[model samples]
Target chain A: EADIYQTPRYLVIGTGKKITLECSQTMGHDKMYWYQQDPGMELHLIHYSYGVNSTEKGDLSSESTVSRIRTEHFPLTLESARPSHTSQYLCASSASTGGTEAFFGQGTRLTVV
Target chain B: QQPVQSPQAVILREGEDAVINCSSSKALYSVHWYRQKHGEAPVFLMILLKGGEQKGHDKISASFNEKKQQSSLYLTASQLSYSGTYFCGTASYGNNRLAFGKGNQVVVIP
Candidate 1:
């Protein structure tokens, strides 16, 4: 089984509330990524990190921000959640190798009402 | 840039075969395939590097054509367990991040 894990499997929060989604992996991977997807839609890359203290925005724009302070921990936070932010957030980690497979977490389903 | 996938959706009966194609305009360094069931995270299926090699896992296999910047996933003798959304992610030279295609939905019926 993959060692990556995401907390709050499901979350329903009111608009304007601040929320944080947690992601951690024990696999000692140097690359971590976050993706957003709507129900039955394509996965859009939002944020990714090459290592601790190195984060980059993906092709897709997102209101959320992520911090990578520890190699095993990468967390995303939404300052003011909105209905438009409702989507499933997936966290994945992969080895530094170029062609290695990425291990994904269970994903956090967020709903902003 | 995200790759383009053909045949947005396909349905097949058990023991049948199908192919899903993914193509990119940019030169590719590697191709990754993943399968995701309803309400679940995508599971890695396989990875093909620039050598144009073919990799197989169980009855499912995939081939990468570096020259044409395309990849194809093959499902042989489809099983009900094979029903899911398949996504192909492509990585270009000098880049480790993968840009994924829209995805192809495959349904297998018994």
Candidate 2:
């Protein structure tokens, strides 16, 4: 019942197009994160939110921007998509407990041509 | 900083055992393990805290060494379902921002 969800499991957009990846969690978690990963590679954190109205850039610098308007919603937007932006985007959520394990969404695969 | 995983790939037969190691350059507060199937997001397996203890999930187990800033995951009596990419994510200040290591691909043959 309680879980993280990502919309548009797969997306194919042309370069220069604006795209938004939607992430929502019903688990009532206070911490949410977005990670970008390539096939067979490690996941790189691109954005994170401590709570509603709180957003921060992650360790890996990304061209995309994220906004947290509500506790359950965190969306990532790219003004001009590029081929290099094509990758799997994963959304995760965790409670405020320092040692709590995070739950991840199914992920969205974006492809830019 | 990102952690480093050893033995990028390994193959094992059903009922075999294997160990994957992950080391971080910075002091680690916790180590998390996850398994990702082909074309899917990773599923959390377990988390080991700073006290250097072991945690288990089914036939999978892991140990964290806070002093060494390292962790090791062990799979005993492997099964076909265990075939996937294993990733170790470390956090210096708990779960705020995790730095993942290069995944270790495990293939368990029947």
Candidate 3:
């Protein structure tokens, strides 16, 4: 099993509420990513971090922002949640070596009301 | 750019076989395969680097053709546990970001 974890395996909150999704890894990987996916749908990359203090927006435009304060922790925050934000958030990490496989966390299922 | 995956979905019986294809417009440096069961995170299946590589473990295997910038995933003698959505992520040269294909859903039944 991958040593990555995502907090709040499931969450339901009202619209306009501010929320943060937490992701942490124990593998000491240099690259981490956040992906948004709907049930049985394609995964859309939202954000990624190459290492601590280095973050970038992914191909998919998302209202969520992330910060990589430490190598082991990368958290995503939304200023205000919306009904359209309801989806599954997955956290993944991989070694900096090119062409390496990425390990994914269990993912957090969020429901916006 | 996002790769294109063929046959959005497929169904197979235990002991049957199937193939899923992923094609990219960009020059690919690597191709990563992942499988995600319902309501679960995607699990890494394998990765094929450039130079026309093929790798397999058990009944599952994949091939990558650098010249064509395409990859094919082979499922031989499938099992029930193989039922899940398979995704292909492509990485271009000098780019660390991986662009993913939509996904291919596979259902293996007994």
Candidate 4:
């Protein structure tokens, strides 16, 4: 039962609202990532963390920021949400030794009206 | 840049077979395969390293060609459970980010 988890499976909020999507893993993974995807579209990496206190922007630019205070946690926060931020956010984690495979969370669906 | 996938969508009947190809413009260090169903997280299928090896699991196999910068996933005797969007992720040497391909949507019907 040990796996990555995401909170607030679904969310709906107005524009200009602040939101944070929580992601955690119990598998002791050292690397974590955040990705955004629309239905039937390619997933775009938003942010990633290599370990505690290490976070970086991914290929696709994002308005959200992430914090890696602990190896088990990596959370993405949007200071001001907008309609453009409405998409499925997926969290993933992987081991440091071999980064080939990644374990993903159930993902959170965000709707900004 | 993201990798390109062939056959954007495919439909098959039970016990049929299919292949999904992913090609990148740059050299590949590794290839990761994953499958995601509707409204669910993507599940890891397998990973192929740069040595041009073929890996398999329960009739699902994949091959990586380092020189060609391409990888192909073969699903034999497809089942309903295999119906999902399959994504191929590639990473270069010493790179932390994974460049994923436009998913190949597969649907298996009875």
Among these predictions, the greatest DockQ belongs to 1
> Compared to the true structure, candidate 3 yields what TM-score?
0.97
Residue B6 lDDT (model 3): 90
lDDT of 1 by residue, A1-113 (tens): 89999999999999999999999999999999999999998989899998999998988999999999999999999999999999999999998635699999999999999
Tell me the spans in candidate 4 whose CA falls farther than 4 Å from its real position.
none
Poorest 10 consecutive residues by lDDT, candidate 2 chain A: A93-102
lDDT ranking, best first: 1, 3, 2, 4
lDDT of 3 at A18: 99
Using DockQ as the measure, name the better of candidate 2 and candidate 3. 3
The lDDT values for all models are 0.93, 0.90, 0.91, 0.89
Model 3 bad stretches (over 4 Å): none
- Candidate 2 iRMSD, 1 decimal: 1.5
Over B10-109, each residue of candidate 3 has an lDDT whose tens digit, in order, gives 9989999999999999988899999999888888899998668999978999999999999999999999999999999988887767778899999998
Candidate 4 lDDT score relative to the true structure: 0.89
What is the RMSD of candidate 3? Answer: 1.1
Minimum summed lDDT over a 10-residue window in model 3 chain B is located at B91-100
Query: Best candidate, TM-score-wise?
Result: 1
Ranking the candidates on DockQ from highest down gives 1, 3, 2, 4
